[model samples]
Target: NSFGSCSRGCTTIDKLHWWGASIGNAGCEELSTQLVSASKPYDGKPARMVKNLLLGGNMVGDACMGALARAAAKGALKDVGALGLSRNSIGDAGVKALAEALAADVLHPGDLYISGNRFGSTGALALASALSESAAMRRLERLSLADNRIGDEGAVTLADCFATGGARQLESLHLHNNNIGDEGVVAIAQVLSRTAMASMTTTADTKKSEKGIFRTTFETIGTLERLFLCTEGAAEKPQEDLPPAELLPPLYCLRTLNVGSNRASTRAKGALAGMAAQRSVECSV
Candidate 1:
C-alpha cells in the first residue's frame, strides 16, 4: 500500500485499539522506515540533528511509541538539542524506552521538555533517575517538566538527581505545575547552592570577596529566563513556604522566578526576593 493509505489504515486500526491490526497494515518494514525517518529527519546531511524533536499530543500508545524512540536512538540521531514528548499515552514501557533514549550518548547537550503525558509521580521519578544516571543528561542545558502529575515524591527524586554532580551542566530547569511544594523547592535550592559553589571555586581564588559576590562563581542556578507557575485566575494563592537560611544557603544564580497557582504566601515571596536582591535574581509571584 501507499504511504498515505498505510498510515490511514494504521490510524483506523489504532483507533480500535487493535494494535496488531495497525502493525499489520503498516507492515514492519514500512513502519520501521517511517519511524526511523521521523526520528532522524536529517541523517545524511552535514547539519546535526541536535535542534528539536517535538512529538507531543500524538496519543501514541502501547509499544509503538517506545519502539520508535528506541529506533531513533539506535539510528544515531545526533544533536537532538530539544525534545518534547508530551500528552502521549506513555506507560511504563514507553517511559523506560524514552528514558533510555534520552540517556543515550546519541542525544546530548540539548534541552528536554516533557509534560502532559500519562507519566504519574512514579513514572516521572523513574525517568528523572534514569536521566540522572546518563552521561548524556549531564550535558543538558535546560529541562522542562510542566503540567504532569509528578507529585512531591517525583519532585524530590528529580531534585536529588539535579543536585548531584551530573546536573552541574544544567543552566535552566522548569518544574512548573508539578506537585513540588516548599519542601521540594527547598531541596532543589540546597543542591543549586552546592553546585554553584563547585563551579565557582578555583585554585587561584583563595581570597574571599569583600562584597561576598564571587565573580568567578558560575551561580549554578541563579534565575530562569522564563517560569510559568500561574494558571490564569489562580495567581494569588501561595502554595508553600521555604525554610530559613540556617537550614539552607541562598541560591545566588536565580534571575527570573514564577510562583503562581499555589499557596505561596507573601512571606515566602519576600524571602525569595531577599535572596534574589543580592544577585539581582528576579522574583515572580
Candidate 2:
C-alpha cells in the first residue's frame, strides 16, 4: 500500500495534483508517510510544496487519521490551503484527530470541505471547539458541514462558537439538510445579531483609517460584510418544516437576513417595521 510507485507519476517533484490517486483504498499510513516524505526534500529549508490536498472519496479511517494528524504535527502539510475529505467514512474519531491538529496550529487549511462523511454531533462539537480555541482558525474562510447528522445541539454549539471569537473572518457556512430546528435558527440569528455590531464598528474604523486617523483598536474584515435583513427565494406553499418567525426577536438584526420565506412574510414585514419604529438610526430590515 506504499503509494511510492504512483508518488513519482502522481507528483511532479514540484507540484502534485493526484485528486483521486488512491481514493477508497488508500489508508492513513501511506498518506501520512507520503506527506512526511514530501517535507523531506529540503535539508534546511521548508519542503512544503503541496498547496491543495484533495483526498476525497476515500475511507481514510480513524487510525489513519491519527497518523495523518501526527504528520501534520510535524509540519508535513504546513502549506496546505484546501483539505477535501468528502464522501469518506470519516466519523467522530477521525474528525477529532483533525480538530486536534487545527487546535494545535499544525494543520492550517484556508478551506475545509468535509461534506458527506458520516460525522455527527460529536464531530461537529469537536470541530467547533477546535475552531474556538485556535486563533489560527481565522485564516479559514469557508466551512461546509452539510448532509451530516448534526442536530440542534451541534448547531447551537456552532452558533455559540460563531458568537464567541475565532470565527470573525468566516464568510460562507453551509449547515443545511441537517437535523437543525427552530432552536438552531434562533442561535444563528443570535450570532448574526452579536457579530453584526463588531463588524460594523470595524468598518467604521476602516473609514476612519482612510480619513487619516491614527487609531488602531479593533480588527476588521478584509471584505467587510454589510447588514442586509432580507429573505431569498421565498417559499410560496407555506412550508411548515421551516422555523417559526415568532421564535425570532423583535429586532432580529442580521449581516445578511433572509426571512421572506413562507406565508408569514407580511406578518414578518410588519413586525420588522414595528421593531424599527423606535430606532433613530437608518438601517434596512
Candidate 3:
C-alpha cells in the first residue's frame, strides 16, 4: 500500500518511532507528508491513531521541523499525546515553529521531550510563553529540555511564567544540564514561593466560605465522649459566597524539578531548598 493510505493496517499505527534513523531533512519531509495525509479521518473511521511521535537523533533541521509543526498546528495530529524530539539539529527557528503550534492548540500532549537540541534562549522564551499562555498546555504533565543552551534569561523567564499562573498541572520539569546560573535559580525559587503562598491563601479563603459542609462535632457524656456527625444544609447548593475555583490560580503541582549540572551556586541551592521546603517540592540542584 502507498504511504498515507488508510489501507493495510496504516490506520492502526498508534506510535511513530523514528529516533536515530539518520533520516535527513528530505526524508523527514517525505515521512511528514505521509503522516499528515494519513492523519485525516475517513469513512467514519478514526484518523491515524498515532499518539506518540519520536524523532530524536534523526538529523532533523529547521526546514522539516517547521513543516511538521505547521502540519500539526493545522490539526493534522490532533490525537498525538506525546512528542519526543531530543538530540536533533533543530535551531531557534524550528523550536519557535513548534512553540507556535503548541500555543495554537495543535495537540494536547501530556509529555514533551526536546532535550539535546541546538536551540538557545530565544527558543526557550517562545516555549515558556506557550506553556504559560496556552489553555491547552494545562494538561501537560511532564516536560524535559535538558542538554540545551537555554541560559539565565530562559530560566528567569520560566519563573515569570509560573508567576503569571501557568503550568498548574505540571508534575515534573527536567531542566538539567542547561546554562542556568545562580540568579536564575533564585528567581525561579522566589516566584514559586510566592505562587505557593497565594495558593495557600486561596485554599484558606475557600474553606472559610464553605458554610454548609458536613462536620463532626464532639459531645461530652457523663462517662465518655461521643462523636456526632451533622450537616445543616450540606445537600443544598453552595451559597453565592462560594468563590469560583477556576477564577483563582491553582496551586503549583510540580512534584519534581531537575536543575542539576547547571551554574547555580551554593547560596542559590540553599534558597531553592528553602522554597522547596515551603512548597514541598522535590528539587535536584
Candidate 4:
C-alpha cells in the first residue's frame, strides 16, 4: 500500500530515502518494477527524476540487487548520482550484477556506498574489473567498501586499477576493516608515491608566473584525496617481485590516509609514513 503510494509519488520526486525499512526481496522487486515504468517516456512529462536512492539496512539480498541491476541496464535510474546499499545482505552475485551495468555504461554513480555487505575478494575483483573496463566509472568520486572482507588480493587488484588510470576522478576511498595486509597497503602506497613523483614533474615544468594558478592548472592533478585502511591484519608473508619504486609512475592526489589498528611491521609502517610525508599527505597509522 505504502509502496504503491511511493511509486505514484516518485514520478515527481528526485530522491528516495528508505533505509532500515526492512523492505526485503518482495519490496525491492516491486520498487524495481516502478523504476522500469518510470524510465520510459510518459505523456511528455519528464521521466522519473530520482537522483539518489538510499536503500541500506533494508535486508535486501543478492536477488533484489539483481532486479535493480536489470532495471539499471534498461536505462532506469540513469540520473542517480548517489547510491547507498550499505548494511544489506548483498554478496558477490549482487555485486557482479551491478558491475555488469557499470561495465555497460548504463549506471554511473558519483558516490557508491556498499559497505557492511557480505562480499569478499570475488566481489571486489568484479568491481575492480568493472572500474578498469568502464570509462563511465571515471565519474565516481567517493566509494565506501569498508567493513567487508575484501582481503589482500582484492586490495591489490583495486590498486592495479588505479595504476591503470581507472577511476580517475575518485577522491575518497574507504576500505577500513576489510582485512587488508601489508602487501596490499604497500601496493597502494607504491601507486600513490609514484603518482606524487609525476605530479612533481608537472610542477617543475610549470612557469614561475603560472605557479600561483594551481587550481586552474592542476585541479585534476591528483587521483585520490582521502584513503581509509584501518583495522587491517598483517600479511603472513611479504609480496615479492615488487617493481622498484622509481620505476613506477607518479600519484599526487592523496591527502589523508588511515592505516591504524593493523599488524603491518614497523618497517612497512615507517616506509608508508615516509612516503606520505614526502607527498605532504596526512598519515594516521
Candidate 5:
C-alpha cells in the first residue's frame, strides 16, 4: 500500500498502548508492509522520538520485517533507545533483517533485547556482527542475546566484531543460554583486554590537548562502566571431572559470568577454580 495508509496505521497505534489481541498480528503485518514501502521514499529526516519498539507477541511473518524496521528507524525514529523482539514471534530471517536494519545507523544505539527466538549460528552471527558494526549501537550500555542457538562459531564471530573499533562504545554484553564455551569466553576476554589497553593508551595521548583529554576521559569512563559480561544458562555445564585449573586464568576481566541451570560436573568446577585462582573471574552456577 501507500505511505499514507501505512502512516495512518502507525499513527493509530502510536499512542494506544494496547491494540487488542485479535488485531495485533494483522496490525503488525500491516505496519511492517507500510514501513517497507515508506523506507524507499525516505528523506533522511527524523520521523519520531520513538523510545521503545516492542514486537513481542505480534505473529508477523518473516518476509521483510528487517527492512521495515530499518525504514521505521530512519529519521524521526532515529532516537529510539530500546528495541525488543523476544519469544517465538519472529523467525530467524525476520530477526536477521531487524538486526541488519538496526546496525545500519550509528545514531539509534540503546538497549537491544532479543531472546527466546530459535536463531541458529548464522542468524546469531549476523545479528551480532550488525550490532558490532553500528557506531550507534556501540554507544549502547547494554545488549542481551539470550536463549538463541548460537554456537561457538557464532560466539567467536560476535567477539571478533566487538573487538573491532565499531564496538568501542559498548558497556555491557549478555550472551546467555548459547553454546559458547571456553573458546568463546577466551575470545571475549582477549577483546576486553585489547579495549582496556587501547583506552589507556588513548588517555595517555591527551597530554598535548588538555581540553580534549578531559572530554575523552569522561566518555571513556562512561563506556567502561557499562561493559558487563553476563553469560547465564549457557549450554556447557561444569563437569565433576576437573581438568587442570591452569586454563581458567584468562577470563579474569568478566564482570558477571552466569552458568546457572547447566549440568556443571566436577571437572567443570576444577577448571573454574583454576581460572579463579589465576584471575578474578566471578561466576554463578
Candidate 6:
C-alpha cells in the first residue's frame, strides 16, 4: 500500500511517492499509526525519520484529528513542524481539538494549512483564543485559513489577535473567500495601520508619536475593559490614553495578509482605502 511505503521512509527509505489505495478511514488510520511510530522502533528495529506529516487531500475529520492530537501529546510526533489538512472536512470540532493542542503547547506548527475546510466562527475563535494563550509563541510562518466561513465576528476576533501581537512571528495569512465584509476589513485595516505606525514611531506609546495623526479611539475601549477589571475605586480613576497601535498585539513579524474574493462592505472601504493607498505590506484583497 502507498501508506505502507511512505511509512518505510520514517525508518529506512528515501521516497516521497505515496498514493492511498484504500477507501474510507483506512488511509487515515494507517498513516496515523505510522506517524505515531515515527523515530520509534518498528518491528523490533528503528525506522527512518519523519519530521513533518502531510495528510492533505484526505477526508480526515474531527475524530481523526483528535487521535493525531493524542499522539502528539504523547510525544509520538514531536518533530512535526507542518500540519497539512487542506481540502478536508475538518470543521469546528476538528479545529477545537487542534486548538487544544496549541493551547497546551503540545504542538507548534511551522505551517498550518486548513483551507477548503468547513470551519466557521466557532473554530476561528477557538484557534484565536488558543494562539492568544499560546506559550513560547508559534513557529508558524505560513497559515492558510482561506475558503472557510469565519464571518465578520471571527474576523474581528482574529484582528484583535493580530493587533495584540500574539502571532508576531507569522509571515503569510490567507483568508480569502472567508465571507468577510467591511467590518472585518476595517478591523484588519486597523491592524495594518497600527503596524505601520509602530514602524514609524520610536516609542512604545502609539499616541505619543509626533505624527499628530495618532489617535486612541480603539485603545480607549480596551482601557475601559481594564478599568472594569480594576477594584471599585481604581475603576473610577482615569487612565492615560494610548493609541491602538501602542497596544498592538504581537504582529511585528507578519509579512503578507490576503483577504481577496470577499464581499467588501461600505463601512470598511474607507479603512481599506488608506491601507490600499499605503500598500505597505503585500496585502491582497
Provide backbone clash counts, one per model. Answer: 19, 4, 0, 7, 24, 12
Residue range 1-285, candidate 1, lDDT tens digits: 101122212333111112223232124335535545544437575422323444455555546545656556666345445555555566656666667666665555355656555566677766777766775554455566666666667766776765544443444555566655665555555554453454343222223356653322222222231122211111122212211112222222234444334343455445544543444445443
For residues 37-154, write the lDDT of model 2, one tens digit per residue.
Answer: 8787567776655666666665665776788789888888777766767667788998999999999988877668787777888999999999988867655656777667777787
Off-target runs (Cα >4 Å) in candidate 4 are 1-12, 203-252, 256-263, 282-284
My TM-score estimates for the predictions, one after another, are: 0.59, 0.67, 0.77, 0.77, 0.61, 0.72
Give the Cα lDDT of each candidate: 0.48, 0.58, 0.70, 0.70, 0.49, 0.65
Model 4 lDDT per residue over 22-109, tens place: 9898899899889889878799887775777878889998999899888887788777877889999999999999888888888878
Ranking by lDDT: 4, 3, 6, 2, 5, 1
Q: Rate residue 102 of model 1 by lDDT.
A: 63
TM-score of 6: 0.72
Evaluate residue 283 in candidate 1 and report its C-alpha lDDT on the 0 to 100 scale: 41
User: What lDDT does candidate 4 reach at residue 191?
Assistant: 76
lDDT of 6 by residue, 165-254 (tens): 565556678889999988888988887776556445333234544554543434232323333322223212333433332343345455
* Count of backbone collisions in candidate 2: 4
Order the numbered candidates by TM-score, best leading.
3, 4, 6, 2, 5, 1
Q: Give the TM-score of candidate 5.
A: 0.61
Model 3 / residue 249 / CA error / Å: 5.0
* Residue 3 of model 1, lDDT score: 11
Candidate 4, residue 39: how far the Cα is off, in Å:
1.9
Off by over 4 Å in 5: 1-25, 33-48, 73-76, 192-203, 207-285
Report how far residue 17 has shifted in candidate 3, in Å: 2.3
